[model samples]
Target: MNNDHDSSLPEGLDLRALSAFVDGELPPVERAAIEAQLAQQPQAAARVAAWRAQKTALQVLCGASLRNERQAHNESSGGVGQRDVDEPAFIVVRRPTPWWQRVGLAACWLAAGAGLALALGPLAPRLTGGAWNGLGGQPPSFAERADIAYAVYTPERRHPVEVAASEEEHLINWLSKRLNRPLSVPSLQEYGYSLVGGRLLPGEAGPAAQFMYENTSGARLTLYITGISRDETAFRLFRDGNRRTFYWINDRMGYALSGPIAEGKLRAIAIEVCSALGGKPESWQ
Candidate 1:
């Protein structure tokens, strides 16, 4: 093998070697080499851990199917007992390779790739410096967290906010102090939404704020705010089912406006809110 390190895997190790090591099929010398590499490389160790986790998950998911297949095979081969004397009952008997596995290492690589995708999710992109938008298996973006918060709190008939809109000043001052930034509530009255209240939320970096608003028809929107290290300002949209969020970064502050509303309407409101909060107009998208 070339053994040159790549973005995804460690030097001197590939999926085949890793899989065989996981299966306890590697010889003593090769296994020792892999063990040494894993001991020295945290990334490689993480990959091995993920593959092991994936194998366990697959065994659980496919247990019944595998049992049925095994039963059929045993019936055709003089009805072998359910368990071997030395080997566990769960172990599949050795036989000719299946069609999928017959394609050689390519199929193994593909299967491992799928397992890796499942194990890493959104974090895989950050790990490999690639682009992936899959959800879960990692902490979500600020906007996605906003979307989850919206879904959680919006349906409540009462107690949707920690502080009611009647005490808007106290809510703003409290959140501002907690967030270490002067926070202000944007007036959405022109868009037929009135402030319902605001609440404190747990953010990835620190405390965050969520300001809720409601229209006469009971439609609700939330504005999520937090301090960010990124100084660049750019507008981006995130959607989950019927909910949508328009998030932007400006002046080291992150803002995400989320609701079950049309995209254009939400974008317009996000722009207006950004402008009100001192974000430059040219940064709106």
Candidate 2:
């Protein structure tokens, strides 16, 4: 029985555990195994010792900075525990200070890549949201995002989206929870289109919601959505090839329906959806 992972190792430690061990972040059982392995292999043990020293050095350096800061305030005449008289200073919050500081695309890519690298770690937090950086300093329009999703996903033979419509109840409930809004997949079955499925996509506004439909002839369509800002009010459409993407934002939420069903057929389907959606008050109001 080979319990070993595929990587260079000391006696019995694996790469992942080795990494955790190096960081002093491993669980006790893992730490024990890594230590046992270290003792058995002189070269590996030396490497692990060097990593431990580096980790210790970093902690000490940061600790020294904090100590120096505390010492600079020569106002404390009381004992060590007397510091409780004052509240701890708040750490500076680092919100993205606007991306267009884009000095260069390469630098932008590096920073974005650094963000993505954090996503690979086991301790990585779940991704919550993002904002698009448009060219020339304008914010990227959600409509443009809809158009892109339309072009890339509508022509697909497989994997058009996630959370296919087979799980209708689950899809609706799950997406509704994520968007913090109730969602209805308007029925277009009366107009030759039927529910095909849907996908859960990530978005800047929230969990991007997507639903798909298909007509009897196999033509496909999709609805994409996420909450948006007030400035995004209004309905719009974009086209490329046989595909069309129609998107709109209201006070409550936003939606985009895209597909390759010919214009006339597509319009009819849209009308059905909109009617089921309580008619387009903004466009025809």
Candidate 3:
């Protein structure tokens, strides 16, 4: 075969071994032998040297591309800018907005909003009863929050309560300390419901507690208690779909009993819980 079209590697050195030797990936013995071959064979030495030069050039090209991309990204994000080094850094320019123009813009926006609302008619969203109402710094109502908390944790199986009911005393003590009040667990064993455990949670106004209870049929009820801004003696019953929530505020503390039970049955349980908390459920309106 012609030398240029040999199509075969040098003796004792395959293409893979030569490539590995050029990449410094060979064992010490193999590397020494490859080095000796390169020293003795001009063709093998030239091939290895060409590979090293190509690797260096590739690294330089890739580094330049990455730097260029980064510079472009910084410029687009307003992070990097080209300016004369001797130029003054700070310059002030005034552009005053006329009151009449501002009023005209406001009128245009108002008219567009009104037209949109009229076009949507009955489909328009309610500004008042929304999840986020722009009230004067008022938090969500107790019933809404208790309903959400109940929905979130009632389906839990293994890790329902942060502190299990077996450690009832510790759970109560820990929550009480976190809430800055002497907390008590109302016994529901009379209604076939016993404490499963309780966990400390963040309430709209302050720290809160969710005391979970389960009956013989695996039915769960959560008694959500938190500090309130004012004392409320009257009870209010709120129903959201299948969930019945009986809530009230007493002695600056808000109490809500949430469960999937009927309104009447949950109310009865709420009465017992309210009485335990030094409140009269009969006075609920």
Candidate 4:
């Protein structure tokens, strides 16, 4: 409708562009083309419908919270407070958020809402496409992203780590400062894996660390660590596609040990890692 066709777009537009169209980021011509496609494509139509439903849910939740805060502010001032005369009763005036903050807010709603799986199912694959693709909204959680990082960097012939294992002390210090937490490299020597190196990665919450270890057979594993939202001790074994990972949250930090090793072996390594991090197997159980 807007143009004859989008030559750059494939027969079907990508998930990222479709998501942008939903968020009103696409040009009017592109928007019209996507709308036309959605009308003919049932699956694409469903995806757009789901995203709209999620957006409406977030607006409702955000509005309700703002209203509650306004009421509380009024009560605190004895029901007499200065207000924006021109602002509508339903609108709340506050500091403006950047574009990324708006995307992050959508992420918050997805996390807290009951439609998490429904919302994420359609967007998970696009997240692994690259770092820049998922800025329109929350792609997947940190765990899955960490798995993608592993897949991307583990096969390198060289430059596997930004800081080599020989610089262990500096590596520990640097990562701890970036993460704002005391970090210790676990000894995997007993399990036939020696530390090759560690590197810094971008995480959902903030900066993250990835420590790599390799055994005599050239098999490698990584310990991924980052800050979590809350302080809690929880452990679970998760398989993202083919990558087997044992992820846990300890105190304020979250860690995941990932590899293609056997379940028992990975579990053993995870336990040793937990013990080194001042936790026990039963505690995680």
lDDT agreement with native, every candidate: 0.84, 0.66, 0.80, 0.79
Which ten residues in a row are the worst by lDDT in model 1? 131-140
Report the lDDT of model 1 for residue 182: 94
- Residues 84-131 of candidate 2 have per-residue lDDT tens digits of 335453444568746557557768899998777655533333332222
**Model 3: residue 160 alpha-carbon error in angstroms:** 0.6
**Cα lDDT of model 1 overall?**
0.84
Model 3, runs deviating above 4 Å: 1-140
Query: What CA RMSD would you report for each candidate?
Result: 24.2, 20.1, 16.3, 22.6
lDDT (C-alpha) at residue 55 in model 3: 70
- Model 1 lDDT at residue 201: 97
Question: Residue-wise lDDT of candidate 1 within 113-163, one digit each (tens)?
Answer: 889877777477788665443344332478778889999999998789999
Error of 3 at 154 (Å): 0.9
Model 3 / residue 276 / CA error / Å: 0.8
lDDT of 3 by residue, 149-218 (tens): 8999989999889999899989989999998999999999898999999988888787899999999898
Model 4 TM: 0.52
| Model 4 residue pairs with clashes | none
How close to the true structure is residue 205 of candidate 1, measured as C-alpha lDDT? 92
Candidate 2 stretches with Cα past 4 Å from truth are: 1-140, 231-233, 282-285
| Candidate 4 C-alpha error for residue 152, in Å | 1.1
> By lDDT, is 3 or 4 better?
3
| Residue 155 alpha-carbon offset, candidate 3, angstroms | 0.4
lDDT-better candidate, 2 vs 3: 3
